[model samples]
Target: MSTFKAPKGTFDLIPPYSATYLAVRDAISGPLRRSGYGYVETPGFEDVNLFARGVGESTDIVTKEMYTLTTKGGSELALRPEGTASVLRAALEASLHKQGNLPVKLWYSGSYYRYERPQKGRYRHFSQVGAEAIGAEDPALDAELIILADQAYRSLGLRNFRILLNSLGDKECRPVYREVLQGFLRGLDLDEETRRRIEINPLRVLDDKRAEVQKQLVGAPSLADHLCDACKAYHSEVRALLTAAGVAFEDDEKLVRGLDYYTRTTFEFVHDGLGSQSAVGGGGRYDGLSEMIGGPALPSVGWALGVDRTVLALEAEGIELDIPPATSVFAVPLGEEARRVLFGLVTELRKAGVATDFGYGAKSLKSHMKNAHRSGARYALVAGERDLAEGLVQLKDMETGEQEPIALDRVVEELRAKSA
Candidate 1:
């Protein structure tokens, strides 16, 4: 083996497992594709200020987890820690909002970078499938995204995951709740850093996972209770729409996502199977994010499902996707003349949409057959100089051990028919 290794917290997705990875990503993106969410991509890194301004400088994602770099030109850049802010930046830069198509829907699948202690279902570099609907504030849009994600997970045969829902009241009333929460936090026995967070962003204190901090927050004021009439009506409409669509969710009063821009409706998808990392994916309505990032005032909502976490959830439930093998036909040539003939036939079969593979160089028939079997091929094609002289090839069923001779010209049609 090479002396070098993959970076400390990254991994290489080789074959067999890579197939499942792609399947997981596709399973999540498929429903969004059918729902009119066009695909979009952005640079892996962006100006550091973009995230600091959009994701909140006080949040852990921006302050502690972001991978920042100072370029030779002295420009501060950072590897994206999440998908939403980058997508919104791309949408605004392209002026998609000015086109008059309200709520420009888009989907994206890619790798994200962050600095954190790696654990089960959590990694420094991870993959996610995300969707965004920009420039609309309707409750139906929010419900549609939640339902679409639910349908995607169900399509993959997953049943044990739960949706945790909450509403982080908008600008009109969130400040009032923040002050009340801060007053309560200050009276509790807490660390200086915890107190500092209450000053910069009191909502983050509710998301703390520390047992001591949580115990002190048992009777803390709730944003759900402090929402103004407008915010409360908006939250009620979102809940009603989700109920009408048959999606089940639990009301989580403390579900303030790690981001600062979320407003009104917020949610997270959790699977009890995952130990500490229970959240497989979640997103909320970030109505103020555009103005925070220096874009037009656009109300938007979206969600991103974690491909890695979803795969882990599938393993925990022991669900296997019925994915087909990469190769259906394996070709083995016995002699020099047979090699030329079989190679040509292999090329023809592949061009005709057949999944095929072949053994290279002269080898014993037994070795070639072993390779064919290990490849998970459905059928094996064998040809020798003698068989070629008669314009025939021996086709053997890998599963049944049945063998028969077919004319050279008929092999392609025979295999195509069987594959179909």
Candidate 2:
């Protein structure tokens, strides 16, 4: 049979590139761990109603891209297109809110499925590093989340990213603004789908990427102007805190997020290097989402940063990720007797917390050394018959090409000391 290919819109993270994925995960999660955001995981698919309600019925995720299926028992489920809805569902089910902690801080790294036409940086399946803070409405919390995300991107030595901030107007005034927005959009000559959006969520039409949609949106009533006194005050507080924290942001008057549940504060991280698809990551506050999903009124805010997009951003900026070297040592055996001894010693070295590998299936010395270089081993141990008889091994520094003999019994200790 011909070799099977991966499903359309999805690709495998094979070998050398897999290391880069791991590095990005570690680098991003480090700050969250230190900041006291505990790790949480949820099922890839949950009840279909979860996203329909939590993510919103009018959004593209539930309306267009969700992969839904029915179990044998007849319950409907869907592969999660985003993490926040699932996380919030779990938190509500577990009653994490009632645990007396004001804001339940969570950090997650996992795959999300979206059934759409895949393009560069956008995929049917992708991994994300996301953070959520539930049960809090403090502007400081909003600023904290933005600052930490900024810190993570900078820590990776990534430049050419801009943080855009906006407020979607709180409940006290957003409904009033939505009416004005809807009225204005209804007058524009647009597609039936967009006009339908004006009836459902007038704000979402602003997020449309189509040039045709953009051209007609010029005179639409902006949410920023429609904000009531209370909504305006809350937005000012968030911006002030962000500014005080030294995080610069562009005030985007038309930055309506894709999701419908967001209220109060919203923001996005965009990279200039990645053409057309400039958004590397973004998050916003969803004050009413908990109530929307049949839970109590719990306010929350979070962001999901795209790992694949971030890597693309790095490549666009002509930046190289400083990945760690693979194996530290490669063991080369001259003969059967030497192989037997070297295998045991290899195990001992590993037990001492060293990354060591052996040349398998009795390859020639030249081929074994070439394999060592290919594996990115820094040092190679040559255990020949003579060295085995003498209870010693020759250590050759791969890069330096310098060799030295050490007693076999002290192999682990010697390697550890030298690597240290």
Candidate 3:
């Protein structure tokens, strides 16, 4: 066994299982691509201040989970705990917001790092496929993002996941709500850490999971009750669009996501099967984020779906993706001369866009055929000295165990036809 191992809470995806990850990423990105959301990538690490300022310092992700580092040059950097901040920073640096485009639509897939006690669906290192629509404040954009995510999940046969929606009242009314919440929280029996949160970010206290703390929050104030007319109208239009689009969501009064940037139209996708870590994905409108990061006021909305959590959700539902065979056609050559001829055929087949593999070294026909079976190939090509002499090759259907001889020169064309 190798001495080295992946760090705790991290995993290496290999083989057939890894295919699911690719499928999930593609499934999510496909809709965004068709909808005009171009792909954008950013470095895995960035100035530590970027997240502290953008994701909010009081949030648990900034205070406790962030993986930080200090360089020899005395620069403090951090592996991004989330994608939105880095994505926005890249867009700002590139001046995408300055372009004529009102909303610079984008999609990205990558790994994010955080430090936490990993559990079944929660990990220290995980993957997410995210989409963002920047520089727009329209409720339609918010509805579109939620619709796109819903379509992606439905296309993947995810039936049990539900959308939790809320509007975290925009700047107009949030201050008033915060003060009211502070008053309520200040009167509670709380710990020093909880009390400190009350001052820095009272909304975060509503998200506390501790049963004892939750007991005290039974009569706490809710933001939905204090949303001003403008915020209320904006949220109502978002809900109306989603309803018209056939997307169902439940109003969740307590859904103050871990991030502090969200304002109005906040949401989460949760699967009941995922236990306490129920959220598979979530995001909201961040109208103030660009300004917070020293960029122009570019309102944005986005969501990052957890690839690992999605996989777990699929397993819980007992649904298997219809993945094609890794190798479509595998060739087994009986002799050295046959090896040269079949190797050429393998190359030709692959160049023709067929997924093909071949046997290596000296091996018995039976053994090579066995390897072909294990490869999950649809067809296996077998050519021995006698067959080569006749310029013919045996094509065996792995699924049906049926074999036939075809002209050697016509193998590639025949396989392509059959595979297609």
- Model 3, 133: alpha-carbon shift in Å? 0.5
Spell out the clash pairs found in candidate 3.
none
- Candidate 3: segments with Cα more than 4 A from true spot: none
* Predicted candidate 3 versus true structure: per-residue lDDT over 4-106, tens digit per residue: 9999999999998999999999888889999999999999999999999999999999999999999999999999999999999999999888898789999
Evaluated with TM-score, which candidate comes out highest? 3
List the pairs of residues colliding in candidate 2: none
lDDT of 2 at 372: 90
Which of candidates 2 and 3 is the stronger one according to TM-score?
Answer: 3
lDDT of 1 by residue, 112-153 (tens): 999999888889999999999999999889999999999999
Local distance difference test values of all predictions, in order: 0.94, 0.90, 0.94
Over the stretch 171-196, how does candidate 2's per-residue lDDT look in tens digits? 87888988888888888889888888
User: CA shift at 383, candidate 1, in angstroms?
Assistant: 1.0
Q: Poorest 10 consecutive residues of model 3 by lDDT?
A: 94-103
Off by over 4 Å in 1: none
Q: After superposing candidate 2 on the true structure, give the runs of residues whose Cα lies further than 4 Å from its correct spot.
A: none
